[model samples]
Target: MAIRGKTILITGASSGLGRAMALSLSHGDNNLVVTARREGLLRELAAEVEAHGSRCTVAVADAVDPAACQQVIDAGLAAYGRIDVAILNAGGGTPTNMAHTDSAAVLRIMRVNFDTLVNFLCPMIDHMRDVGGTIAWTGSPAGFFGLPRSGPYSAAKAAGRVMLDSARVELAGSPVKLVALYPGFTYTPGLDPNDVPIKALIIQPERAAREMLGAIERGRSHHMFPKRIRVLIALGRLMPEWLRRRFLRVASGG
Candidate 1:
């Protein structure tokens, strides 16, 4: 379905790809409910959305909290009566050396990347089971396999990606459409790579948002881009363990 004339909820709207999606989709008959922990940025985004002739609700909440996630969804429903689409996009991760990273750091990454989505997803599925809606998430190509210095993040994303893929099968013929968006390295505010070698693979947030929006509109169950990184990831998966480890060690700056 076209994104126009729909009630949409986007988490992590304060910056990065979420911000871009909100801005791109804000126009005409759209009613947007944007949520993020940063109240100031969310308010700024709300103003921009309203300026575009669309209704917007700013929800300041942490995605990791189930109550906070529910509150945002509740606010959306209260404001617009229904949510036709939800983009579960709140997530961030920091690079770490697994050999030295603390357990707390690992858990933090898992909760941010996986638990956050689960918190909102439960409510979304409950409300949309009968009425039907579209649910999309920001997964990563890194999720397909473990990446050096990002083991926890890869695990969390893999969990989310596999769950969504399974849900797509189980919910087949159901009104709700589950979309798993696997984006390659994208240049977003949260991503500041000290290693310049990684920069070559990074696409801009605007480009990633457009691709994600197009996938959601087309009701695709799984979408991965851009083609260059996707091909690299695909090829990586086919390599044997020794070769794959060598490739990752070099790419991650051994």
Candidate 2:
């Protein structure tokens, strides 16, 4: 389905890919309900969306909290009567050597990436089941396997990806479409340029948003972008476990 003239909910709209997506869809006469913990940025995004000739509602809330997630959903339903699409995009990751990092740090990464998705996923499935809608998740190619210095982040995204895979199968007979979008190394605020080993693999947020939007419009069950990432992932899958680990260690700067 086309994204135009739809009531869409976008989390993590304060910055990065989420903010870019809001602006892209704004010109299509979409009703956007944007949410994030940063009230100031969200309000700024709302103004920009309105300036682009779209109706936008700013609902500031943290994605990790179930109640807060529900509140955002309620606000969207209240403003637009129905949400035709929801982009679960609230998540961030930090590079850390798991051996030195405390348990709390690892758990925090899991909560931010995994819990945030779950908090929104459950409620959205219920709301969209009857009325029919699209639920797209902002996943990563890193989720394909654990990499050096990003174990927890990989685990969280992997968990989310598996859950969505199951959900897609379970909802096969339903009208609800589950889209898993895996973007490569995107140059966003949350990402440190120095941490990226290969500069060529990195992409801008605008391109990532356009790819994600296209996936949703086309109703693709799984989409991983920047062909180079996909090719790398495919090659990794063919390597033996030990060889893959050695390659990853070198590629990720040991």
Candidate 3:
């Protein structure tokens, strides 16, 4: 359970939450395998991590490609020999307006959010089961229920939640752990403050990542950030379907 000396692989490490996690874990006696399509940024991060005395490896692979997924696994294994944790964080959302969703755009989102998620994690899980590792996927409060303009994103993340839970049940007796990081709206710079007025309450990525590491270390079933958002998601789920839809519509300006 100690995080000080384990090896962890983090996708989406070029920016945002993944970057924060890399920084948070840099001082630990750990090996970090960070990946993204942005090779330059990834190497830069690797330099920072290495400077802190942790072994750092960088891979440039598209999250959605089966080949890329293989490359990620190979690279991580090649560098660290064992993976203690896999943070499936490479994902993005399209503009919620369906009219703006051209065929190519929808396919692209599906590829990155769903296909890539599975492609990358499936092989990693197979490897983990042999050695008893933890895998945590990045999910969102939006995945808890359908909200207008967030159709594909919600569906993909909801699938992640369900699939991870099912996988956990299947491996009930194993040391391997499957978890979801269901974060609420983050106060990322330039993101709309109008939508999440209480964004000040949003925990920074390092805080969230630190919590996530704790959950993994203890073998928690699942975890969510911003306790209030988790409460809202639970309430929204228990609400009648019609009421839920209405509330979501009103809240999202649909």
Pick the TM-score winner.
2
Better of 1 and 3 by TM-score: 1
Q: Which candidate order results from sorting by TM-score in descending order?
A: 2, 1, 3
**For residues 142-215, what per-residue lDDT tens digits would candidate 2 score against the true structure?**
89899888899999999999999999999999989999999998989989988888888899999999999999
- Tell me the deviation in Å of residue 225 in model 1: 0.8
Instruction: List ranges where model 3 is wrong by over 4 Å.
Output: 189-201
Candidate structures ordered by lDDT, highest first: 2, 1, 3
Clash pairs of candidate 1? none
Which 10-residue span in candidate 3 carries the lowest summed lDDT? 188-197
Q: After TM-score superposition, what is the CA distance of residue 110 in candidate 1 from its true location, in Å?
A: 0.6
Q: lDDT per residue, candidate 1, 1-80, as tens digits? A: 25899999999899999999999998656999999999999999999999998899999998989998999999999999
Cα-based lDDT at residue 200, candidate 2: 87
The root-mean-square deviation over C-alpha atoms between each candidate and the true structure, in angstroms, is 1.3, 1.0, 2.0
**Residue-pair clashes, model 1:** 0
